[model samples]
Target: MSHIEIFDSRYARLKAVDWDFTDASQDSLASIHPYPARFIPDIPRELISGLGCDKGAVILDPFCGSGTTLLEAQRAGFESVGIDLNPIACLISSVKTKELPPEFLPVAHDVYEQAKNTFDGYVDIPTIPNLDHWFKPDVQKALSSLLTHIDEQSDVNLKNALKLALSSIIVRVSNQESDTRYAAIDNNYTANDVLESFLTACNKIHEAKKRNSVNLECSKIFNQDILSVLASDFDKPVGLVITSPPYPNAYEYWLYHKFRMWWLGFDPIQVRTFEIGARPHYQKKNGQTEEDFRKQMSSVFDLLSDVLLSGGHVCFVVGRSVIKGKIVDNAELIRNVAENHKMVLVANIEREIAATKKSFNLKYGKIKTENILIFRKD
Candidate 1:
């Protein structure tokens, strides 16, 4: 069959499958922390089940933003691996899959008490730009004190969990416009009640941990760029790979969480230089374009193809991008790359943009469609 006819057949097959997941809870353990542009867990869950991965097979999410795929794979009783360049993303993913020890709750309560009692104690806050504009004096003090107390916890897992919890509260208490927007539109929203917000966030994390008590020991999440980590050996061949890679010229993730990363003691600048598919990286001045996107993604696909087991599946949830009046079909781009790597297109389903999941505004033009492109190794 011709390539156009092949694509049409796959598109039709995807349309016939039910993509509705209104009944699935968006408030899973993965929801405890926030990350921009996270795909729904139902997509990965269904893909894994549909692929029919055998017991002990390894599932991989190369751009595992916020651990959505990892959490779903764990719940389904499979070992999973996630790789990302963002430290905060790694932290959130790690915390999501953590199985709370018996001592987690009591220890968390103790830490909370320490933080409240030592609320006045001072710690050197990271020197973030526009710090004063984003956080009020009192809010800064409370956050520093809380982070200081959280760092005091002896258990690394519990400490990181609290840190993740603290990261969640940053947006609620800052001058940032919203979760999706990179630029801050100050509406005079100051977190006057920082302590209360921190406490509430801690309680929510505790409850979320209790609710998602699955043994997530079957997963390994790495805080490194995808290209850097592809050389590491997996215990078993990857049976399935699923992820939502960043779209070209859209969503500057590091800038979006700049203050949050600083508040939690992370150097956002360190990862900024190597962030794949960032908007600035594709600017005309950068001497890059949509073709660069295809090249970079092709390299990653080559890496994935090398590690994948025979007949294993790769699924990418990507959206079309419009830059300088040129439209790039990301799904088709990925399909072409995968085909060159000896993979067969399985499906390309265009799905409606969920009301809550719509993050891009008119400034970025309308992202009227997203494609879930599935491919199997030949």
Candidate 2:
């Protein structure tokens, strides 16, 4: 199965696409990112695609951030399972994989009309006492009405699909620009217009899928820690293991997503406990100092070793960040830990991801390029 050697790809040297995805502009409804590197726990699917895609084969993404790795695996025709600390991530993944019933859109449209009409005379939604700061009153009311009606539906799949739709809208409907803090609305407001965000997300989902002619494959997202779930025995061996772990000096998955976490069914407080590189933890502790990060990554690697199958592969993509006037060479030195675990480095892919202006003033302030390290078990 060529399991002995690390597979190579054009993306290894040049940041090239390894698989086929229709143009984002062509698929107007899709939530495809302008920046591919934004994907958390990413797998180079185009590179992995060259490995092979056999039906019934399975794949696992331990750090499956919003399902990018899982989606690619499924697109490659393999059954896949994903786990993430963020509930919004799990929701996004789950909704993306579900193959909406043919009648879903038409039916949902009817519900949309009902929601709009219900808003026609009401003028305002119930005052969400805590939410006025983030959204206009009219927007909040429009959202609640849709959420209430969507909940009234008896069908579970439809309900989830509807929820997924709603979840997708959080970015556009709010003062939140990107998934970053600067892109957010005034936090002083306690109530977020969750219901409105949900309906907008639902509409986006239907539109995105329709544009792609995508038949989303079956997959499941667990809103739990990968470490806790790894002990469970699976019925099949995952043919591929594609995921990117948290990078040192980067974002805290929870805080970067705290607002989203609070709006969804998840509790932001609980999510904060598990998120890596959280700003609070970063500042409170030693920060991403060389010694601290090395120690932390080593343990995480060991935990990962326990989950991977014999001879299976683990690909980690990371970037160097300036922390206190020094560069954190995550990919270079990480091999030190890999060797300790008896893992071999197959390849190192270099690339870049967007960074903020403040990032530039730091020790590694340049919009630093990242690396994709492919490790295979001996």
Candidate 3:
């Protein structure tokens, strides 16, 4: 026995994997940003470690979200490239991966001092319309002062960290219920003091950086459509691929984060155009059936087949989604597409997951797993 069943084994491993979102406070993981992209990174690193990648090997995540794979790859000593359509995702990933020099803490202190000084000097806070509506004048003023101080800093690393600090406050300062679908300002929620939140995030980053004793220099981020990104010509570099593309009609990631996108200077209106499987877009089209999903995903595999290096492996992490009362077999469709592209099916791991999502329309909420499809270009 090979210790694994070839038939449906791929689906089984992924079905076994669960997303255990921590109950820790909001500031626990990478500030107030989205789920860590480390899910795939951790798996990829485990697969590639024995293959002689000693921090300089190149890896890629074509559908990198929040650059989790890229960040984790960099930490594990692999040069990584990430491509995504969402600008906020790009910004968040870029900012996090930016290596703050050893002296970043001193620089952060200097920035903080400057901010406090500015406030003491009675500098006026710039008005961000909706922000004022939620935060008290004093809280907004302090945050504005800190933001301005960060803008004035010359140290690029500290500047980026300051920006991260700002983003980390989104939930803490909002009035919305914790871990809910909506986050708006309210008087009863945790009175997240802007300055306190900033300081806390700043310290968290510092501690994380300090504890990360390993040095790495292998992360690159790009903002672009994955389909187009994969189609672009490369300079003769071959590397293993790892990624997780969206389902046909499940999550509208861009719309879900529209508020954060707008706050971070992203134009939400424009991003709606390229978001894959956006709920709003699907609704506008009347509906998204299983066949439509199969075709769209097939197109993605077709594109991937073109750029993958000879003998390279592509690991696709995806979840099953329900479409029009049909159990959409995303894994099978992807396998079919991969076979159509002449790639050999290496494995399908079902990750047993846990979660009864409340946002789902009662049918799709009982998600118990996902699939990790492994294919080789041989």
In the predicted model 1, the residue pairs found to clash are: none
Report the C-alpha lDDT of model 1 over 1-378, residue by residue, as the tens digit.
111122435335344345644444466565677777666777888887767565667899998878888888888888889888888888888887776556666766676677678766665676778888877776777788777778888877888887887888887777666776545555543334676676677778888878777775646787887767664556677889988888887767887677787887778887777787677776666556888888888889878888898878898888788766788888889889989999988776676665564422223647765777888886
Off by over 4 Å in 3: 1-41, 50-57, 120-134, 154-156, 183-185, 188-192, 230-236, 285-299, 354-364
> What is candidate 1's TM-score against the reference?
0.88
Superposed Cα deviation of residue 268, candidate 3 (Å): 2.5
Model 3 local distance difference test score? 0.61
Best by lDDT: 1
State how far residue 163 of model 1 sits from its true place (Å): 0.5
How many pairs in model 1 have backbone atoms within 3 A of each other, for residues 3 or more apart or on separate chains, i.e. clashes?
0
Q: How high is each candidate's TM-score?
A: 0.88, 0.75, 0.79
Give the worst 10-residue stretch by lDDT in candidate 2: 18-27
lDDT of 3 by residue, 49-153 (tens): 422232333677777776666666666666777777887677666666666667666766776677766665675655344665555556656666776767777
Worst 10 residues of 1 by lDDT: 1-10
Q: How many Å off is the CA of 40 in candidate 1?
A: 1.0
List the RMSD of every prediction in angstroms.
Answer: 3.6, 6.2, 5.1
